[model samples]
Target: MTAVHLADLLTLGARPAAGLLLSLTDRCPLACAHCSTDSTMASAQSPGGPFRALVSSFTPDCRPELILMSGGEPLLRPALVRELTASAATAGTGAALLTGMFFARGGGRLPPAVRRAVTGLAHLAASLDAEHEREVGRAEVFRALGAALDHVPHASLHLTAVPDAAGHAYLDGVIADVRRRFGTRVPMLVGAVRPTGRAARRVPVHPPAGRGATGRGATAPCEFAHWPVVDQGGTVYACTRQSLLRGGPAPAHLVLGHAARDTWRTLSERTLGDPLLRSVRTLGPVTTRERYGPPPAADGCATRPGTPDPCGSCLALDPATADATARQFATPGGRAVEHTVLALAAARPPHRLAAARGTLPRYADLVELGWTG
Candidate 1:
């Protein structure tokens, strides 16, 4: 099998239903302050049987082009990692893993089990940032990454920015160091860390300017709703807010299906054919609600008061609103409008998409590193 580069993964991620995300486990050894999942060693660990069953169901014709496995830390389940990698390969799907480098904390080298876990992966990515550095030193991560390159055909780094002078400086320093150490051989994907999970209280939230209104009433298309995410317990969600889809019940609009019961084909069909989702992908959450649903209540959002929130709008959608949206998009004009918006969004390069999605505009281009195209 060939290696899948960072650019390829990001491009695939932009297209609807082109990829799949599996949260192998939520348990993480590290206590990164900015962790989006608030994952800890004490986090609930679910059985891997449901995850295996879902991947095993992917046939060559129905498999996603790529599979990205993550968690509080994915390497904790090395044996399962190896198993899923092999399974995906058999169906001609390339698989990748993202780790927090907890295995490299005491490191001179990657643990034998961890090395075995990454053996057949198409790509390997390690998370490095100010918070991660506190638990796992930069030198230890670099050594593990060096050995990782030997096992996987391609590799990259995932960095999160804090959006202040010091935060931006940390990102700049790390980017320079990675380039100096690995040169152009390694690419990177940098995204702004949101005020979610453990970072909620620590990081201040900066709402997008004119977030509810995009000047001409146009909103940035939501690429997050494109790929389906299978949570640790087998429930599948349409967006990146998998945390919301856990515990109690997931929002009806975002719930795709459960992996324990649905196949890749079923999940993909619902993703592409769901009327409410189609509207969200094209018109965005705020626009979708404005155009088809009732107006948002003044007290709709407690966290982001007086702000027009795209996600909150989507979450608060009513059944009547969903029905109205379905009716509107069933027409030829609606279809044409949807196609045009998606085409325009798809034409953008990975770097531009990164910037549009809230990565620091200056460093977004780092994702295109080592790409000839």
Candidate 2:
């Protein structure tokens, strides 16, 4: 199998139905304060049978091109990683994983089982940050990552960057250290800590200042709506937002289908053919809501004082509004509009796509590292 690079993930992420995100488990041994999933050793962990069934259902013609497995700590079940990646490979799908490197705490050595899991992957990414360092030293994490680079065809770092001075310095130091050690061979994807799960209070997430429901760039297509995310219980969602993964049935529009029941072909068709989803992908939630749904409320979820959240508006969509949205997209004109928006979004460069997806705009270029194109 060909190595899958960070650039490959970012580029493919921009297209609809090009990839899948499987949250293997909600359990993690670490207690990082900024944990978005609020994961811990005691967290809920579903059995792995459904996950294996879903991947096995994928045929070469119907499978997603990439399978991104993540969790509180996916490597906690190293054997599952090896099994799922092997299944994906049979269907011609490349697989990647994101782990917290908890096993590296003692001496940065990979357990025999963990080493076997890493060897079969197309890409392996480790998370590092101030919060993570409090549990596992940076040196230990790096040493483990260095060993992983040898086994996996491609490896990268997932770093968290806060907006303050301390956060900025930490990011710079880490990037430099990683460059000195691994050079440009490893790429990095830097994103701000979102206010979700346990990080909700610890991290300050302010909406873009002066941006309302119809603010500047409000109509940009939502590329994230492309990849479907499967949570621990095999429930599939259209968006990868962590908050949606919270244990409950997703809103009608966001819910795709259960992996145990739905085949890749069924989920892929819903991802592409659903009118409401198509609208969200073409014109962002804000524009979609305002154009078809009821007039926007001044205050709602994800909305702060004088600021509006497109995602918030999307989630709060009423049944009447949702129906209206579907009706609008069922028309010939609406389908044409969607096609135009997708064409423009596809023309964007990978770095720009990364930035648009809410990563720190300046640091987004790191995703293109080592890419000849």
Candidate 3:
């Protein structure tokens, strides 16, 4: 109930999914080459009406604790942003926005529409990275953030860097700059560039894995499944990882529900009540397959690290497999493991959770950049 910090949100994965990520629009004015959403002015987007209706369904007792809005650039729909944020307030659900800061390039004061949209929200996050720098000057972005700090309750940066020497140097310098400028008032959520969106074709994408005849043997649970992500089409999926939602028929296991047809209560219940989903959240996809699945096959499912192209082993489920997953995860033993795994993962501070979930190790320490916590 205290003011929320960027570091605090990064750690939400360790707990029951209290957050939902809603992609406002796929249309971005700035074409950052390394973007994970592959957003463009021409890209498809869903209507704001359904999205508004969905958020309108939240009740004080059943709504998500947090709702994070992003897109090719969520600011493109400022009016909807303002509406949804106000609606969230009525339900006691906090709202936040993640933007590319397209409006910040020239470095004057923020446009009235952008300021009005972000006003009274819990937080605002600006995206800065090597790729984004090519489109928007770092100085300009910083200057814009400086101006934005006026209207919002809190402000932060979401930096994306590929892991390497250059990445660390950038993080160190930028973090230092932020510290000097904002002192500890600003916090950051630093992450590595994954093989998603435009980068997928260039950067080889690989999920973490281990070798096994049956995925059931390993205990690596996927906490990412906790936060349900709603794409621009109003379609909701289990994780925020863009790659999982942008293409193909959503692997059956990950599809939650569409915002148009489902209320917050229905979605939240499905998220928390489904045994298969709970298993994936607690035991991870691979181990869920191993525990309740047929012998592991190399069908793009992640296996031992040495195995080539270690993708998620349990991408989807068949009818019989879903049944087994439901039954097995329903048992007392399964419930025990779920609580234990969640407890262990949640035991750390928010920054530590960020470190374990793929933020660069050396610079990972900097994710705790602001806040006394």
lDDT of 2 by residue, 71-165 (tens): 97999888999999999999999899999999999889888899999887889988888999999998899889888888998898989957678
TM-score of candidate 2 on Cα atoms, chains taken together: 0.93
Instruction: Evaluate all candidate structures by whole-model CA lDDT and list the values in order.
Output: 0.81, 0.81, 0.74
Write the residue-wise lDDT of candidate 1 on 266-367 in tens digits. 999999888889999988887888888878867644455665667667776778878988887888999999899888877789898766666677887898
lDDT of 3 at 192: 74
Candidate 3 lowest-lDDT run of ten = 208-217
Question: Compared with the true structure, what per-residue lDDT tens digits does model 3 show for residues 204-322?
Answer: 34343122122122445665678878889888887656565445566666788899989988887878777777877777766666667655565543434434221245555555677
Candidate 3 accuracy as lDDT: 0.74
TM-score of each: 0.93, 0.93, 0.90
lDDT of 2 at 355: 81
The segments of candidate 2 whose C-alpha lies over 4 angstroms from its true place after superposition are 208-219, 245-249, 299-303
Per-residue error for 326 in candidate 1, Å, reads 1.8
- State residue 109's C-alpha deviation in candidate 3, in Å: 2.9
Ranking by TM-score: 1, 2, 3
Report per-prediction Cα RMSD to one decimal: 2.9, 2.8, 3.5
| lDDT leaderboard ranking | 2, 1, 3
Provide the lDDT at 198 for model 1.
Answer: 83
